[model samples]
Structures are given as structure tokens and as C-alpha cells.
Target: MSDGDEPAVTGEEVRNVADLARVDLNDEEVETFAEQFEAVLADFETLDEVPEIESEPDLVNVMRADEVEAGLTQEEALSNASETEDGYFKGPRVS
Candidate 1:
């Protein structure tokens, strides 16, 4: 949508986005982001006017063959760990 047609983004909306993104933003930052968001929407409006190209390159999944190769031995793998438990690296529990 054009900037004129775009709905105003309030400080509450910016704050909500910060919360969802797991970031903290003060009131001034929220107001600044709201203004920046309006500018970004205006830039998007310009992009909407660009003509679509018919010969765009299609994206394809590129992968390599998966083959088994020699890897570290049990002793070598656990050698660098600060602690080991039953031939495995012992680390702090995630939970």
C-alpha cells in the first residue's frame, strides 16, 4: 500500500513486535521504530510497481552425495572434553 494509504503504526505495535522478538525497547526507541517502519512500507510500495519478469531463474535444491567417511575414534573424541561419562563428553544439562 502507498504511504498515504498505509495505516499508522503506533508505539504499542512497535513494543509488541519487540516483545515477540525477545528484545527490549524504551518509549523513544518504539517511536523511532514506528517511523522507520513507515519508511520501509513506502519503499515496499515502490517495489509493488516494478514489472514482473518472466525469465526469472528458478531455485533448485543443490546437494552432494552423502557418503560415510572415517571419523574420530572414541578416545580421540572425548580427549578434549573437560569431563567424560562412559566414553561420552559430559556437559551441562540443557534443562
Candidate 2:
């Protein structure tokens, strides 16, 4: 679509953003994106008209229970390690 049929979001801004994003866009694509961006912004602006809630709703934990479970044994865990010591994987010591 041409910029004439598009809303207020400018093609220059779209092109600038595309440049910033390292996107390779031609003239037609920039104009189309500028129009789309304007429409999207208008849609999001409707959220501003929604009435504010007076109080917060109760919130609760929604997670799985944590429990100890059997996993790979020490020897199995360190089987791929280049070095192991005292049933633990060994790595270079850092100061």
C-alpha cells in the first residue's frame, strides 16, 4: 500500500527502525510496514480505555512440589569427565 492510504506512522520511522534492526526492506515494504504499525498502535491504544481494577485478587503458588528423587550416581555422572577425584568431577582450581 502507498503511504497516502496508510495512517500516521511515518515511512521514515519505519525505514529508520528497519535500518536499526539491520533489516533489508525496500520502499514498498517500508510503506506497508508503516501502515501496519499505525494500525497495531491504534489497537493497543484501546487498552488505555479499559477501567482500572479497585483491588488486587488473591494469588497463590502454582507450581509442582519439590522432592528428592534418584538421579545418576556419582560414578555415572563423572563417567564423561576428563578427571575425577573422591567420587566428584575435578576441574582446574581458580583463585
Candidate closest to the true structure, highest lDDT:
1
Predicted candidate 1 versus true structure: per-residue lDDT over 26-95, tens digit per residue:
8889988999987787788889999998996988878887999999999998888999999888889999
lDDT of 2 by residue, 15-75 (tens): 8899899999999999899879988887778777788988888888899899999999877
User: Ten residues in a row with the worst lDDT in model 1?
Assistant: 1-10
Using all chains and alpha carbons, the TM-scores for the candidates as numbered come to: 0.48, 0.53
TM-score between candidate 1 and the true structure: 0.48
Off by over 4 Å in 2: 1-6, 60-95
lDDT of all the models against the reference? 0.86, 0.85
Error of 1 at 51 (Å): 1.6
RMSD of each: 7.6, 7.7
